[model samples]
Target: MKERGQQVDQNSESFTFLGKGTDFKGVVSFGGTIRIDGRVEGEIHTTGTLIVGEHAMIQGIVSVGVLMNSGKIHGTITAVEKIQILKPGVLVGDIRTPVIAIEEGSRFHGMCDMGAHLGSGERALSLDMAPGLVATAQ
Candidate 1:
């Protein structure tokens, strides 16, 4: 029996969510998806997925399998799989990934390292952005 308004195919992976008004500092590591809508001022490492909400702010090193962001981030980020920054997201720092997608209205300014991932047979993120988007990489 499914509850009303429930998602038809909700993800089974339980994730940790840091909602608004929450502020965390130090290292946060998890194996499942995590959604942040607050502020984090330290390292965040995960082996699954990380979602940064529009109101979120993060600063420091981030290592994850996948990342979807619509907030603001400043630091060194390493995503083993891919990274997607949606509209209004702003990322300012160095990123090491093989595949990265920045949509229109997003912003990114940093250096990208993708060669290491290609030769290691590992997936990665990129430094590409669509038109009307602000992106600068080295």
Candidate 2:
């Protein structure tokens, strides 16, 4: 398992980096991995991994295959595989993922849905509806 994790990390190393001191606001769509160490306010969609480095700040809707956050984010996040919030990270948004891990000292303030049924094409419908309506549908 550790070896597999290492391999994944190695594969993700070839990524585009949004270095610190930068600020962006718009839609960002990409493949492979991306590491952000700056400020972003917009939508982020990717079919690969997203790494929010320490000191980063993001406010948007994030859709990705994997999310590893060590910064601050205020928005909704949907991960196809997993989401990990490292120590000192802050996430103030709703989360929808198959798996999630929040380390000690991490701060999270929002709803998290790790329902096993998320992949059956039903989750999108629920997400589009109002919160009250979603509850009634469930």
Candidate 3:
């Protein structure tokens, strides 16, 4: 019925929605997708996607698998997969993710670490150990 990796077509999915005028504090965690359109102060951790609506304002830490933001966020964000900042989004904090997309009207003012190291068990091939029948061949 519902898919996890599908970006769009979230209507079919059963997601958690925090509408406008809602206020929340402390940490929130869940699976699947969630949409926030209100004000939040504290941390949010999820293994699923997080969609921040245009009227949302979030502070503190955010850790999720994927993030789609169209609001204002002032804190650290760590996404395991990717992050998308849509139009009118304002993110004012550091982020760590493998992939990121910022729209033209979005504003991101902070550091971004796209992973300083390679994936697990992955490494650059050394010429010394590589065989190409060149001068380095012994």
Candidate 4:
């Protein structure tokens, strides 16, 4: 079991770090994992993981497989897998994820939509019938 854990850790993708005091603005799309400890303003989309270190600040739309935030984010977040907000973290935006874990002392001031079918391959259809009338079309 221990060897399996070690192997998993070794197989994990390396993280690209955005160190403290760095500021970036624009779109970021990548695979694997990324850790940010600075400030970012734009959109971030990835199919891996994102770790927002303490003292980090991000503002924009974020879509990822997994999100671990320990700082602040002000925008919309759509995580396919899960989202974890550590203690002292702050999120001022809406969240859409199937699983969410928020530690104590974290601040999330926005709406959260937790649906099991969120990332499922499903489509929503609109009805074009009258309000009080039923329509049957074959």
Candidate 5:
């Protein structure tokens, strides 16, 4: 059987959506890599990479393995592997992820706890709450 979360063939046709002119509302979930070039107004969950193109706009939660943004987002994000915000990217919400890379021109306006780098890769659900990915101390 194929391993869970294995990368899709780089040579195969990938999934993509152009949202620059369309308005989307509701949750979005997918397995393979995806690129959004429009607007989304709901939660998004995916096992593979999720790319928010430069002209894209997102206004909800995002949970995925790898997230890269060159657009504008107004919600929380939980990324298991990594998060990257390229130049001109704008984010206005909390973030919980293992690895994060932000370009000099990017703007972020919210709380960030980089504790995931400690290896647990778990972000505390709340300041007084246990991280969702780990067992709590008894």
Candidate 6:
């Protein structure tokens, strides 16, 4: 559940990036937890939590378990479980997830949906914010 303001359980895993000192350019796939401290320019697939640092930048697609962003993301994001946009976070693309947390001070200019719960396979996140597109967020 989300309040008028965005909030997530702190008990959830946390990841941080220092930013301004790292750069990445390729496809990324991992499990456990991921935190972007610099920059990424490719497709990202993970089975753990993903955090985009305040100054980090991402320019590609992302598919993960959970996502919390405090930076800039310019691509599509497919999260299987949940997503949170921290203050000052900027996201400019489509989002496919079951749960979304949008903070008061964040910037998100895109469509989103929540229709991935009706399938027989691994439950995917739905992007009801759009039409005619189905994605797997989990």
In candidate 1, the residue pairs with backbone N, CA or C atoms under 3 Å apart (3 or more residues apart, or in different chains) clash, namely: 97-125, 98-124, 98-125, 99-124, 99-125, 99-126, 100-125, 100-126
Better of 4 and 6 by lDDT: 4
What digit string (tens of lDDT, one per residue) describes model 4 on residues 14-122? 5577778788888988778888888889999999999999899999999999999999999999999999999889999999998899999998999998875634886
Arrange candidates, best lDDT first. Answer: 3, 2, 1, 4, 5, 6
RMSD of each: 9.3, 9.2, 8.4, 9.7, 10.2, 11.2
Q: What is candidate 4's TM-score against the reference? A: 0.76
lDDT of 5 by residue, 101-121 (tens): 999999888987667667566
What lDDT tens digits, residue by residue, belong to model 6 across residues 1-138?
A: 111112334456433332466666778776567677677888988878888888878999999999999999999999999989999999999999978999999999999977765574664444875345554443
lDDT (C-alpha, whole model) for all candidates: 0.85, 0.86, 0.86, 0.84, 0.80, 0.79
Q: What lDDT tens digits, residue by residue, belong to model 2 across residues 49-138?
A: 999999999999999999999999999999999999998899999999979999999989999998845567865554566788877879
Instruction: Tell me the lDDT of model 3 at 96.
Output: 96
Which 10 successive residues of model 1 have the least lDDT summed?
1-10
The better-scoring model by lDDT among 4 and 5 is 4
- My TM-score estimates for the predictions, one after another, are 0.78, 0.76, 0.77, 0.76, 0.74, 0.72
Clashes of 4: 0
Off by over 4 Å in 3: 1-14, 121-138
Clashes of 1: 8
Better of 2 and 4 by TM-score: 4
lDDT of 3 by residue, 83-109 (tens): 999999999999999789999999999
Say which prediction, candidate 2 or candidate 5, comes out ahead on TM-score.
Answer: 2
Task: Give the runs in model 4 whose Cα sits over 4 Å from its true position.
Answer: 1-12, 116-138
> Which pairs clash in model 3?
none
For model 2, what is the error of residue 33's alpha carbon versus the real structure, in angstroms, after optimal superposition? 0.4
Per-residue lDDT of 24-125 in model 1, one digit per residue for the tens? 888987778888888999999998899999999999999999999999999999999998999999999999887899999999999988664667865544
User: Which candidate comes out best when scored by TM-score?
Assistant: 1
The 10 consecutive residues of candidate 5 with the worst lDDT sum are 1-10
